[model samples]
Structures are given as structure tokens and as C-alpha cells.
Target: MSHRFLAKQWSLIYVRDVLRVLVARDFKLRYKRSVLGIAWSLLVPLAQLAVMYIVFKEILRLTIPHYTSFLLAGILPWIWFQSSLITSSMTIVENRELVKQVGFPIAVLPTVTVLSQMIHFLLALPILAVFLLIDGLRPTLALVALPLVILVQFALTVSLAYIVATLQVKFRDTQYLVGICLLLFSYLTPVFWDFSGIPEPFYSIFMLNPMACLLTAYRAILLHGQLPAAKPLAALAVLSSMVLSSGCIVFLRARDRFVEEL
Candidate 1:
């Protein structure tokens, strides 16, 4: 039993090390030829914020108070979700060499994609903080809830990543379909707009989207300086847990056949 326990512990450590290496490799390859390097993480969101501000505030004439803060809270998280899903969808196919290795943790490919994008999200938060300060939204004890919110979003993204990655292995079109779905989801989610104006069934429908709930929680904590509603947040956590379990099962079962497909 003791020998078995030690072996299990060592296996976990090996997986951890492999995950770390893959994530680092992704980060380097992502920005390797770039001049701005990691600064692109900060800049990309800001650029998106600028476009959103122009479209919503300037063109659509939205009168949202502290609109910059509102937009940043939404855009930063959404970008992380969008980028992770798209990239992870292709991760297994892109790393056919690694997937060919026997006993490899195939799930780590999608996980690495999600985590690397998450780091980008965290890096952009300071910019959001600056905007929040500019808008006079002082830091509150509500800030303490931010990490929990991040963890919930992380779980949700990683779960979806696993599902999409598995699908992409079998169906090459999965990447394009995911891209189109994400495009629709961006508008469906309140990334550039507030859901308050949305009426009954629509509001209820939007809430059904986990990303909608996650974004709402983010806006509440960062912009409004408070915790999100308990019921929805708890529901999201539960839903994410279920999806993750399902995703892992699907990925593991499909993995043995992956080599044949590839």
C-alpha cells in the first residue's frame, strides 16, 4: 500500500510538471516572434475595449454609467473564454506528435490552453483596475470574491475546452463550428451591453447561459463592488462541475481512438 501511494504521488507530480512545461511552451510560442510579447495581452483587451466603446457608447449612444468599467469587466473575461475555446479546439490536432506518445495525458493539451489564456486574463485585470479607479469605483471587500469568480470561470472554460478538443479530434470542422458559435455567443452574452434592459423570457434565457452568469458576476464584483447573487453563482459552480466530469469521461474514452483518427 505504501509503495502504491508513493507511485500515485509521483504520477501526480509528473503530470504537474508536464502541464507546467506545456503551458510555458504555449506562452513562448504564442509571443515568440511578437515585438510586444506579453504586453499584447494587455493591449489586445484595450483595443477591443476601444472598439466596443466606439460601437456601443458612440454609435449606439449607450448611456451606461462608468461605461469603460462596464465594458472592461465584460470584454476581458469574454476574450479569455473565446480565445481558450478556439485554441483548445485545435490543440489536440495541432499536437499530433505529443498525442502519439503512449501514456501521455492527452487532457493536458486543452488544460494548458485554458490556463495560458487565463493568465492573459489575469494580466489584463490591472488595466480594468485602472479604469475602475478612473470611474471612481474604489476597491471594496467585494474584491476578495474575485478569485472565487476566476476559479468558477476557469472550471467552466476548461470543461468546455475538453469537450471541444475531443470533438475536434474526430471532426475537423469542429474548430470552424466552435468559431461560429463563439461569434454568436459573444453577442448573446452581454459583453458590450447590459442585460438590465432585457425583458422577462429573454432575461431568463440569457441567465441560462453560464457565460452570462459568469460575466454578470464579474461586473458585480469589479464594477459594482459586490458579490454576485448566490443562487446563480452556486448553480454555475454545480453546472461547471457536472460538465467537467462529463468532459473528462468523454475525452478519456475518445482518446484511445484518437491515434487512429489522427
Candidate 2:
């Protein structure tokens, strides 16, 4: 029942082509009637960033140097994860007809959702770059490590997406639960504020969250022009790998039941 055994076998392998097709089809279907096409994905995050910048910098007078830059480091990735999860949570259920009509891999559901959002994040990078320039910040060579940060983020977000999608299919309350959890977790993480705001005992605990490590490193490289300290980077590497491995296991376990449930 592992299916892991058949992963490479032609008959059992979930070919990459299948995933590509699903992603392509889903992306087109997503923006079909929209004038903006795929641009909508980046637009939402950009709009949110503008609102936050106006409120925090103008109204609250909370002047953090390179404030918008600091936020871009957090917000783009946050939107990617949040957006993907929100859309993916119902992917299987929404594609119920496809599930019964096609015998293809059910695991493709979450991957396709994540890929579409990834495309959006890529488009928004120029917008983030503009904020960095306005803050008089020039990215260092360490900026190349942006891909590594994205790699860690993808590992965590996709894994969570897979687990959530399956759970949402079985338990309708899962979406509401995820919304509440995301609300608390975003605040708990240093997305809007800095680590200075977190209390003593909580500091060590909160750092254990991968998002903490990712955002912290992103800020360091983009703003400070130095590499992320070894400890946090290592922690995220360990955490991301574990989550990715487990996500695959969890997806395989539920996929069979998904087709039946559909």
C-alpha cells in the first residue's frame, strides 16, 4: 500500500507530464474570463502591500527603515503560501467531477495549485524590487540566495497545502479552521512586526517556526547584505525536509480514499 514502491515504475509512477498538464489546464481555467489573466495573482498582494505601507508608515508613524522593503520580504512569500492554501483547500472537492472521470493521480491537485501561485510570486518580484530601490537599498550578491529561501518556502507551503486539501475534502470545517490558524500564525510570526516584539520565553519557541527562519534570513540578505546565520538556516533546512517527506507520505495515504470519496 506504500505506493512509494511503484513511484518509479512506469505503470505506477505519477509522471511529471501529468502534473505539468494539470498545472497548465488549471492556470488557464483560473483566469479564463479575466482581462488581467495571470496578473490578478500579483495584483492582490501588491494592493495589500500598499494598504499596509500607508497605514503603518503614514498613520501609525512606525518608521522602520526600508519599511516597504522589509514588508516585501515577508508579504510576497506570505501571500504565496496564504493564497495557495486558500485556493488549494477546496481543489479536490471542486474538481470532484474530474476525480471520478479521470484516473490520474489525485496528488496533482495541490501541486497544481501551488505552481499557479508560484507563477504569481515570480511576477511580483519586480514590484518588490521597486520598493527596495525606493528605500535606497541595493541587493547584494547574497540576493541570489533568494531561490534557496523560495525552496524552503515551497517545501513547507506545498506540504501544508497537500495536507489541508485532503482534510478539507473530508471535513468541510477545515477551511474555517485554516483561516483562524493562519490569522494567529501570521501575527505570531514576525511578518508585520520585528522579533523585538516577541517576549523572552516565546522567542526561542517562535524561532522554531520555519516561517520565522525564512523571513529572518530574507530580511538579513535583502536588507543587511549578509548571509543568514548558520543556525537558523540549518533549522529551516531540517524542518523543510521533514515536512516535504511527510507531505508526500500523507498525500499518498489519502489519495485513494479521495477518488472513492469523490
Candidate 3:
């Protein structure tokens, strides 16, 4: 509720330090009492890949070459997207004491959530690389575009995080709703299956999902060794920018009210 604090620029040097500390604290707290510690980050996605591979590749006998690698590529980014939203959605409410006590930019809370999960996502990438090598898949020159893909995904995730975190401060059920939507979204995304079978107008509609476009790009670079087509890539770039700009607008508008709501 302090006007001066609200007026403070979020780009201040101290704000960067606070963001670093908050991200580290979240990362440590996530694994604090665990037996395997950081290993769990690597294990969780690999385990999910195993079960999904078995069910889809073995039981249903869906034949896609190097299916394990394909699944790994999609699942890693999806996990980051899903977990970031789940945790970030409650960040403001969970840290109400800090919100009331601090005058710093409150937006850092959701940024920290996305960054923390990004660490897990990065850790899981080596596993995907190993799978690619084992499958005799050498990444092409198109692999250089991966950083751009990651940037796009990060923008989208953080934008959604900001919106959800700000809203959940007022409506406590937002987290539950996010969970249900993420569950449904997993099926809608091309995580376990190929997008080629989607067919017609539905395929075009599905491509509009930013996550779908992102996952497709990931598979293109890591699995298929090619860049995503310019059309979808351009669409993703436009969408990410819009989401980021709008999310910042929404979060800043709601930020002043967060303390009272909390």
C-alpha cells in the first residue's frame, strides 16, 4: 500500500538480487528434506516417460520410431510448463507475509517460480540428449535455434504465471482450476502422440495452442534435427509477445490490491 514502493522501478539493482535469492530459496526448499535431492528432478520426468512409453508404445503398440526420445522431448518442456503454473498460481497467497512486509516488486514471486522450474527443465535436457545419441540421432545445424525456442516458451510460461498468481490472490480456487485445465491440456497437446493424425480444421485449431507449437519446435530441433516451419514459428513469436505484454499489464494492475487481498 506504499506509494513510493509501488513507484519504485522493478529494474533496480536490489530487485535483481532479491529475484536471485528468491529463486535459490525456492529451489532449495523444493528439495530440502528429500533423500535424492536434485535427483528427483531428473527422475520424475524420466519415470513419466517410462510409463507413457510403455502404455502407448507397448500396450497400445503405437509405432513411432524412437518413440522414447520423442516422448522425452515433449514431456520435459510440458513438465516445466505445468509445474511452474501449479506453484506460481499460489505464490502470492503463499507468501502473503512477504507481500505485506516487503516494498519490492511483487512480480518477482512468479518470475522466481518460473526460473526455479526452469532449472529442473534444464537438468532433464541431458537425459534427452543421451536418448538421442543412443537412438543414433545427430542434431542438425537447426539445433542452434533452440535458445529462441526456449525464450518463446519462457515468455509464455511466465506470462501465464503472472496472470494466474495475481488472480489467485483474490480467488483461492484458481489453483484448482489451473490443475484441472493442465490435466486436460496434456491430452490436447501432442505429448504422447503425433500431431499428423489430428486432421483438418481441428489440426489448425490445435496448432493455435502455444504449448503445442512450442513442443513441436522442441521435437523439430532435438528429435528431428530441423527448424519449425516459419508460419507456426511466426505465430508463436506473435502470441508470446502478446501474452507477455498483456500479462504484465494485468499483473501490474492487480498488484496494488494484492496486499489487501492477501
Candidate 4:
């Protein structure tokens, strides 16, 4: 029994080492052959910000105060969530060769994808910081809670990634479906607009969205310079845990048939 326990410990260590290597490779490959490289991460969002600012703020005349900070708080994380899900959904199918030919821990493919995109999300933070400063907002002690907010979002992303990756092994169309759904959902999220103006029933329902809660938490910290209200954070933490457990269970059960499906 002691020998078996020692072997299991080493096995976990080995898997962790492999995960690290895969994440590095995926991160590098994402920008390979691109002229702008990682700058594209910041550029894509900044370009979107420019369009939205022009349309909503200039054309429609939405009177949002400190709009850049508010919008960045939402857009950055939405990009992370959107990009992670879309990429991770295809990871299992994309690595079908590895899934079939190697004795690899297949579940780590989506984990690697999510972590690599997370690095992009983190790299884009300086842009947000610059916007905050431009708006004259200083970093506050509430910034300490930013990590907790990120952890919650990461949990939610990984959980969804696991489920999506597993489904993609059998359903090749899952990636396109994910992209379509995200495009539709973006309008529902409070990314470019203030949630305060939303009416009662819609407001309550919208707040239930994990992304809405997350972006609100981000704005609370970065835009308002205060820690988020405990209620939404607690709710998101619980939701993320439950979803993560379900995702892992689904992925593990489906993994055995992945090679055949591939």
C-alpha cells in the first residue's frame, strides 16, 4: 500500500510537469507566424473598444461616466472567457493524433488551452491600468481582491472548457456552436453599458449570469476602487465549484471513448 501511494504521488508530479510544458507550447504556438504576435491580444480588444465607444457613446449618446474603465473592466474578461471557451472546445479534436497515438492525459488539452489564453488575458491588464490612470482612478486596497475574482472566472472557464472539449470529441460542430452562442450572449452581458439602467425583472435575471457577476466584481475593484459586494462573489464561487465538479465528471467519463470518436 505504501509503495502504491508513493507511485500515485509521483504520477501526479509527472502530470503537473507535462501540463506546464504543454501550456508553454500552446501559448507560443498561438502567436506563431503572426507579425504582431502577442500585441494582437491588446489590439483586438482596443479596436473593439474604439468601435463601441464611437457607436454607443458618440452616436447613441449614452452618458456613462468613466466609460473607458467601465468598458475595459467588462471587455477584457469577456475576451478571456470567450477566447478560452472557443479555443478549448476544439482542443480535444485538434489533438486527436495525440489522443489516439500517445498515452497522454487527454483532459489536460483543454486545461492547457485555457491557461495559455489566461496568460493573454493577464498580459492585457496593463492596458486596463493605463485606462484607469487616464480616468484618474488610482489602485486601491480592493485591488487585492482582483485575484479572487480572477480565480472564480478561471474556475468557470475551465469547467465550461472541460464540458465543451469533451463534447467536441464526438461533435465536430461544437466549436462553431460555441462561437455563435458567445456572440449572441455578448449583447446580453453588461460589457459596454451600465447595468443600473436595466429594469427590475431583467436586471435580476441578468445579474444571475456568471459573466455579469464577474464583470461587476471587476468594475467594483477597478472602477469603483472598492471590494465587490459579498453576495455575488459568494454566489459565483459556489456556482463555479458545482459547474467544475460536473465538468470534470463529464470529461473523465467521456475520455475513454475519445480515441474511437477521433
Candidate 5:
């Protein structure tokens, strides 16, 4: 019975068109009257990389090779994950009026937020490539894994977004809570540091973080010019799939209550 209901709900014939329109609307609204427009997407992460480089590389002198490339590889994906979660958490609540309207799929609200932020993430990649080139690195065969890494991250991001969005409808504090968590997780995730520097049981524990594995994969492929090891990659794939499937089930079950809760 639940399977049949899920199929009916998932079979939105116009879902693609709706998603396209929502993504377009979000893009326009995001840059509506901004002077720099899309260039801000490139500049923001680059500016962040510059500051971190000076503080960590120059001042403190954390001796990671190709530091700039390493930072970009992690920062770009972290920005995507951060922005998607924050925005998607507020999606349904922000669109309460539309959500109340019949025929609206509440799930699409968070999905739109995820897709929109993903566009920004994709736009920032070329900047990462430029930094890599400036660091005297050329693309290698391992770069082929880049798309696979992105696919897994996207699944993970959307999965978490769905769950957060659903919960945020009832608990208005979820957005603020998500922001706090992102800040803490950013420092913990080895974005600026090397995983090898971590020690003992703590190192083993940090590996359990999905973002830790994904960021390591990005650094390995883009900065080190090598593919991530099979074991960690396989683990991340499985974790992402599990999260996506479970998140979808939770979102579908809670969706009908959104309007009532709002």
C-alpha cells in the first residue's frame, strides 16, 4: 500500500518542467539587482581560500603541499553542502502559502533549493580548475572520478535537505540549528587540514563522517592526481544511498502534514 502511494506521489508528469522553472526563478531572485551578479559565486570561495591560505599557510605554516589546490577542492564542495542545507531547511516554511495550495508537492520545495545551490557549486568548479593550473598541476585520469564524487554528494545533500525541510516545518529553529551544526562540522571535517594529521581512535572516528570521505576523495582526485581508495569510496556510496532512501521515506510520510503544521 505504501509502495503504491509512493509511486503515485513520485509520478509527477510535469516535475521536470516545474523544477526547471523553480531553478530559474531562484537564480534570478538570487542575483536580482546585484552588481557583480554570478561573479560573486566565484569570488566568494576564492576570497575565502586566499584568507585561509594566508592564515594557515603563511602565518601558522601548516605545511600541506599544493595548499591552495587542496583548500579549493574542499571549500567548493563544503560551500555547496552548507548553502543547500541552510536554504532547503527554510524552503517549505518560506513557501507556506504555496504549500497550502492543493496539487503542490511539498517535496519539490526542498528539491528546488538543492538544485539551485547545485548550480552555484557547478559554476565554482572552473575557479577550482584555474587554481589547480596556477599550482602547476594538470588534470589526470583520476579526474574522471570527479563526477562520481559529485553525484554521491548531490544525493547526500538532497537527502539531508528533504529531512531538514520536513522537520523545519514543525520546528522553526531547525534552520538556526543547521547553521550552528555546519560551522562546527566545517572545522571538524578536515577542510583546511590533512586527514593524516589526525591521530589514533579519533582518526578512525573522523573517517565515519561522510563529508570527510567525500572531501578526501575530492582532494585525492583533484590535488593529488589520484583516485580515492576503493574501500572508502564504496563506503561513501553505500552511506549516501541509504540516507537518500530513508530520507525519501521520511519526507513522503511527513509531507501530508506540512500544510496542517504550517
Candidate 6:
């Protein structure tokens, strides 16, 4: 019955309610202003897929098999991760008023931004299903692995958001740094090209990215109707866990000063 443990449990309660409220508010605000409303979520990812398909499949003459469906599989998760992280970086700054006033727990802010994006992503699944069907893809029991992929993705993203949001709040430059990291990491990841298609040395070097493992699983399930190899998934789980634990430690230390900084 330590006081610290009780305080943390209380904060977790606040976070759960706060996350739901923020998600609902974001859904309302995003669609309320536009005629097409939430359709934009589906459209945006579809447009990105179309452009990549045309550019890579047609223009570059890259003969990737089942390229259309494969791209969507990889890109949707990437878009979710990118969109969430970019928005989460500014979570505290955007809520500066709340930080200054009232005794709201600041840790909830990152979860809020991530949860809002999750709502949009869930709505986009039907659109993904349409394109997936058009590509002659059908459901398989292997699809059960998909949820595991999403769970790992959530763990990874939550950690990154917690760490980066804290840094962004403390040092303004960290915000810009996150943007730059995203730009560079996208190229490094196997979004446009598959490691399997490449020759040895380069493929070996590229597979080192943990996200490449996730991207591979996505393409395998969506295009090939197969499950991810357990080894890579295990590696990612370990790496993500380490990152997440470090993020929590950093957040806990920095959270104490957030109200004063704001």
C-alpha cells in the first residue's frame, strides 16, 4: 500500500477516461467541419497507395508481385505510426492551458493523440477491405496474426510517443528532430521495396530495422496469406519492450516538471 503505487493507479484511471474523451472530441471536430467528413481518412490512405502503385509499379518498372495490395498493407500501418507520432510530439504544447491550469496528469496527453489516430485507422479498415478484395485477396486464419501485429505496433508507438513528447516539451528542437527522423526512417524502412527482392548484403543490412519485420508481416498476411515467422516477431517484441520500458522511466522523471515548464 505504498503512496506512490496509489498515485499511479489514480493516474491510470484518469488516463483511461481522458483518452476516451479526447478520441471522441477528435472524431467530432475532424468530421464536423467537412462535407465528406471521415471519408477523408479512407481517401487519404487510398490516395497515397494509388500514387505509390502508379509510381513504383508502372513508372519504375519494378516487378513486385501483387504490388497494389502489398503496398496498402505496408502503408496503412506506416501511415498510422507516422501520423500518431507526429501529432503526439506536440501533445503537451497543444494542451498548454491544461498544463498550466488544473492538476491533470500530463502522461495522458500522448495516449490521447495516439488514441485519436486509432479511431481514424479503425474507420479505414473497411476501405482497406475493399481494395484488398479488389486485389483478389481473401481472408485466412493467418489473419488472426494481424491483431498481434497491431498490438506490437501499439506497444512500440506508445513508448516512442511518451519519450518524444517529454523531450519535445523540454527542448523545442526535439520536435523538429522527430520530423527529420521520420523522414529518414521512412526511406530506411522497406515501404517502397522489399528486402526479399534485394540481393544479400543490402537485404541483410536493411532487415536490421525492427519495423521492416512488421512491414514484412503485413505484406505476408495481406498478399501471401501467410503468418509472420515467429523469430522476427519475437525480436521486435524484445526490442519494443526495451524501448517502452526506457520511455516509461524517462516520462516518469520528466513528468514532475511539466506543469512548471508550461
What's the residue-level lDDT of 108 in candidate 5?
83
lDDT of 3 by residue, 1-262 (tens): 4666455665578788998899888878988999999999998898999899989998999988899999999999999999999999989998888888766578788989999899899888888999999999998999889988988888889999999998898888999999999999999999989887767999999888888899999988887888877789877788878988899999989988987787
Per-residue lDDT for 1-262 in model 4, tens only? Answer: 2335434544877779978999888867868889998898889889989988889889998898898778888899999999999999989888888888645777788878888888988999999999999999999999999999999999999999999999888888999999999999998899998887878998999999899899989999998899998898998899899999999999988998997778
lDDT of 2 by residue, 1-262 (tens): 3556445533534567777788788878879999988778777877878898898889987857788898888898888888888888988899888777645566777888898788788888898888888889887998888888887788788888988987887899888888888888898777767785668898888888888888888888888888877787877778777877787798777887877777
Alpha-carbon shift of residue 173 in model 4 (angstroms): 0.9
* Candidate lDDT (C-alpha), each: 0.90, 0.81, 0.89, 0.89, 0.88, 0.82
lDDT by residue (tens digit), candidate 6, 66-105:
7777787778888888888988888888888876755566
Candidate 5 per-residue lDDT, tens place, 1-262, comes to 3445545655656788778888999999979999999998888888899999999999999989999999989899999999999999999888888888766666788889988888999998888889899999999999898899888899899999989998898889999999999999999898898878768899889988889989988988998889987698788788888988899899988988886888
**Against the true structure, whose lDDT is highest?**
1
TM-score, cand. 1:
0.94
TM-score of 3: 0.95
Error of 1 at 206 (Å): 1.3
Q: Regarding TM-score, does 2 or 5 come out ahead?
A: 5
- Those runs of model 4 whose alpha carbons end farther than 4 Å from true positions after fitting are 1-10
Clashing pairs in 3: none
Candidate scoring better on lDDT of 2 and 6: 6
**Candidate 1 residue lDDT tens string, 1-262:** 2335434544878889998999999889989999989998888889989998999899999989999999999999999999999999999999999989856777788999999999999888888889999999998898888899899999999999999999998888999999999998898898988888878998999899998999999889887888888899899999999999999999988988999999
lDDT of 2: 0.81
Residue 150 miss distance in model 2 (angstroms): 0.6
Error of 3 at 28 (Å): 1.4
> How far is each candidate from the true structure, as Cα RMSD in Å?
2.7, 2.6, 1.7, 2.5, 2.1, 2.3
| Clashing residue pairs in candidate 5 (N, C-alpha, C atoms within 3 angstroms) | none
